[model samples]
Target: MAQSSDIEWTDATWNPVTGCTKIGRGCDNCYAERFAERWRGIAGHPYEQGFDLTLWPSRLMQPEAWKKPRMIFVNSMSDLFHKEVERAFIDQVFDVMERVDWHVYQVLTKRSSLMRAYLHKRYGSSAVPSHIWLGVSVEDEQHKGRIDHLKQVNSDARFISFEPLLSPLHAIDLRGIAWAIVGGESGPRARPMQEAWVHQIRDACERDSVAFFFKQWGGARPKSGGRLLDGEEWNGFPWQIVPKSIIEQLSL
Candidate 1:
């Protein structure tokens, strides 16, 4: 599916890939897997395969058709770097982003090591395109290495999604990160997030000059608890890292 998105950090979503297998704690209650599984066995349903990791070659050019320039979150329903996804397919996805150049793409994944390797092989000595912002998901301190992997990639618009923030991440090093989005889990079994934990991350981002975005203090529903952090919303965006050309286009 390629259309507008409700994700606070992005303007739209383009999923050339769909369905995914759980990789870590953050994925324990994946909203994607849950939603996909609901359509299992219902022939004709997009997720009839039931979160079985399917690729859609037909949707590769979805971004190009939308002439408008906006921040698009690539593969929101799946991980592009999943081991099952062919490297050739990943190349095509990258090619579309390159050709579309006008729209900004945010490619976030929990498969950090593989992502780093792919970036190295694709861009090599050259820097990654600024419009293609690369990011990783960090659920807690245990997955902090994902951040380290993100830092290793040679991209100016590197970001961290501390979503489903299960625990404190005070030790995370936000040095090379341009932006950080923090939010709690939301669903039937949504976990509660401590105020102290969020404050710590926001404080760290401030100290490092990193743009911080506090998405939600999620509960039963995404907006159940509201998105206020200490009486104010943390909507810091990494506008400084946006590509000059894309920024100009958006301004127009």
Candidate 2:
């Protein structure tokens, strides 16, 4: 499925792959899994098989059809690095991203190590495509290693998503990261996020010159708590890596 997204960070979503297993606390209340499961058993439905590992070879060309440029959140419904997804299939996904240079594809994943290994093998000391942004989902201090894994990649378009911020991320380094997005978990079983935790990351970003974006504060629903941090909204973005041509088009 490919369409405009309600996600605050990106303009659209492209799910050439679907379904994933939980790897950590962050996956406990996955909105994507919940949404996909609801349509299970429905005849001819896109999610008829529910949140099972499935690939859409047909949807591989969706982005090429979108003439206008966009910020697409790749695989919002699944992880591109899931063990079930074959390496050859991943090549196809990257191939599409490589071909479609107009759009900015944000590929965020909890499997940071897997993604790092894949990129190392694919690009091998060369930089990844500038428009295809690589990022890792970090929930707390325990997953700090994911950031390190991201830093090892050969790309300038690197970012980190701290959504469902589970605990205080004290003293974590942000030097090599280009962008950071922080938010609390939402939904019925949502976990509470502390003010200090948000500050910890935001301050680190400021000190290290990384872009910081505050997505939400978490509650029964995604927007149950408005996105605010200390009486202000943080909407930092990294525009330094955008190519000159795309920047001109974006201004239009």
Candidate 3:
């Protein structure tokens, strides 16, 4: 079963794999790492590696058991495309996704190069499952190259996550993108996110007519900060990709 997530971009989280190590500045204060340490004593805890690279093959079939259609965050506690995760394990993960066509899986990773290489060698362009929405994490200008790499992937739905946003990104080219999710970092040592940064992305999305979702205000504690920009919440998605038939079916 998929666990309902507080993350504004998705409905639920399904960690077929868990545990990851810091790979970039955006990972300086990982919420998943902190959560793992706090719940170390719990049974069946997926984050047993305590921020160390580890894979949990036992969780691969969890989505198959889910009856309803859901937007599942794949590997929320870990990066499925991490270097430590073997190619065989990735195949198993893809196998589960292939079988469970009812659920929409959102897989985001910082390892865009590895992802590109894997997709090219293993699945190629035609093999990217339509139900899977692939995305890359671009926290700063240095990581902006990830956008280009993500564009090369053969996935049907491609997106970008600018969460824990560290700097103002200007002239973002949303050429072949489907959606963009922006949010500030939130934690005890969370960094401050500027209002101008949020507006810049929002404005770009408006101009390009790309789907934009504002996730949070991220402060010392995200809950205390809340997810309000100007006065309302921005939870929009690209309606074009989301078929009208599915919309009608969901409405019923």
- Candidate-wise lDDT, in order: 0.90, 0.91, 0.82
Cα TM-score per model: 0.97, 0.97, 0.92
Q: For model 2, how does the per-residue alpha-carbon lDDT over 29-141 read when each residue is reduced to its tens digit?
A: 99888899999999999999999989999999999998878888999999999988999999999999998899888999999999999999999989999999999999988
What's the CA RMSD for each of the models? 1.4, 1.2, 2.2
When summed lDDT is taken over every stretch of 10 residues in candidate 2, the lowest stretch is: 243-252
What TM-score does candidate 1 get on C-alpha atoms? 0.97
Record all residue pairs in model 2 with backbone atoms less than 3 Å apart, i.e. clashing. Answer: none
* Clashes per model (N, Cα, C within 3 A): 0, 0, 0
lDDT of 1: 0.90
Q: Per-residue error at 144 for model 3, in Å?
A: 0.5
Q: Could you tell me the TM-score of candidate 2?
A: 0.97
Task: Give one digit per residue, the lDDT tens place, for model 3 in 4-61.
Answer: 7777677788876677878788999998888878766566765444566666677788
Which segments of candidate 1 are over 4 A away from where they belong? 248-252
Clashes of 3: 0
